[model samples]
Target: MMNCQFVFLLLVIYMLYLFVGAAIFSVLEQPYEEQLREKVLNMWDDFLEIHPCLSEEKLEDFLRTALLVKSFGVSVLRNISGFEVKWDFVSSLFFAGTTLTTIGYGHPFPISLSGKVFCVFYCLIGIPFTLSLLSIVAQKLTIFLRDRPLHYFHHRWNTSNNKLEWIHAIVVISILCLFSFFIPAIFFNFLEENWGYADALYFCFISLSTVGLGDYVPGERSGQRLPALYKLLVVGYLLLGLVCVFLMVEIFKNLLKHNQILSLFLLGYEAGRQDEEIDHVSTNDSEVPFAPRNDETTRRRVTHSASPNEKSYGSISPSRAPAIIT
Candidate 1:
């Protein structure tokens, strides 16, 4: 059974390899088809010249339009393969990495329908699964780290147990927000050297949110050249933002525990094991235990029965509370 599954997997892999290889070959061989098509058209034109009804100018225009359309298609194919431009090995690596990561960064986008379709499908299926898997791994890592809290735990041990600790967390988070968000915005704004701080902040917000509104792109402000540094910065910020968001959520959870305790106090509730018997008695008056005592019982009682914590309630009185039992 294992051998059969292995063979099946290998067969599937082989089929995928063949499909990819064929796609590449088709793209590469498209020029030959175009040449053959041109040759056929030239022959037809020769034949048409003997009995020409269409004007030369009109024919020329038609041919020009056809060539333009053909060029467009060819350009698209080349763009999808990342072949049109002369890129170094590092640049190619960056492109491939960003594409797979789904950050796409939009500096290098798919021009062809085939490329766009592949991107749509790839991101649709891949991003969620990848994110979910990463989240799971992060959660496990968090537990491991908590077992040994890094850096902050040592600081926490010496600090007083007060609101200051929570403030410390907020301060750290604020610093992170500044670096992860504000620094990039400042740099981009400097490059653009035109937009106001508000605009920069808006751009930063939109980018971090992954809304990609396209109203403002930082790299576009500067003419396109080695976008690698900017791309790396943006990708790094995105990744750090993700991790920071996770950390903040954990901090909020911890803070909420204190909120819960505060709520208990505000609501006049004691945080301890409650006497369930009191609850049962309060639920129904008919279920409350009663003992009848006449006037003779009140006169004969000489000993004090109530503890200092208990209030004495005389039996057989309309305004009387229930007699306290030891």
Candidate 2:
């Protein structure tokens, strides 16, 4: 129950963060969008005034086609006026977040040399920071789950630790899959004008895994209402999904730590056993065979025989001599 409450609190905090980001980006981008629209309209009016021979409808069609081309970062007719600003604050912020997370959704990118240089430095710092943060959070969340719910189940059922860990992992992973992937996919399906549930699910999976193929980015379609809000929510979903992925990884790590079946696949244990056997054989080979100690009579006979006053030691062996001290 405590764990459930903690989860709910985290959800609330995440929702609040999404809302705040949406509000800020909306405020920053809306004015720029409006200004750009006004500039385009003014250019069209000037064009119509200068080319009075052309009908307004034809002029509008030509300008619309030209604007479409401009959207793709190409300008076939350069003299025609259109607004082209890609690095507004909100887009830049979103790009930075995606880059740091390694999501790299290619909706927007740096085109200038200085901007590219800045991006290189930014990622060098950001990637490690993001990875460290993910690891720390993953560890804490795994410990919380293990100690609270997993412990409860283990003591109540008198189960083995390995079994309990597996049970805990399955339950937690199912919940994460439901919330982070399935539920968000449904939400994105509804919010994105062109995306179906399958596409949304694929996008969520790709973004969370940091594959970010860039084919199905959300909130960038034409005629999207409250696009900033949608983009912000997508960012929040990506972040939360990544956290759950990290949590799953940590849980699986704990499970593998005690899994006998998986341990059999490791060669380290075999290597250790071979080392022990080799040490045992080397120890046996190094041992010196014991010999019986010579008695005092044997020593005296050897010394007297070697003095040369008597027969040679070999010829006056103990077998040929009378029993002296004995």
Q: What's the count of clashing pairs in each model shown?
A: 0, 0
Error of 1 at 254 (Å): 3.2
User: Model 2 residue 284 lDDT?
Assistant: 69
* Clash list (residue pairs), candidate 1: none
lDDT of 2 by residue, 1-326 (tens): 44445456667979999999999999999999999999989998898789899999887788788876555544455452322233555556677878899999766776679978998998999999997898788889887876688778778998988777887888999998999899988888998868989999998899999999888867555556666666676777777789899998887766766866655444335545777789897676445232123433333434432344444423455566787695
At residue 24, what lDDT does model 2 achieve? Answer: 100
Per-residue error (Å), model 1, residue 61:
18
Compared with the true structure, model 1 gives a TM-score of 0.42
Lowest-sum lDDT 10-residue window in model 1: 264-273
Which residue runs of candidate 2 sit more than 4 Å off their true CA positions?
A: 1-85, 264-326
Per-residue lDDT of model 1, residues 155-273, tens digit only: 66665434644665577568657875687678767766667777887877665555555566554333444465665655566566655555555555555555665444332222222
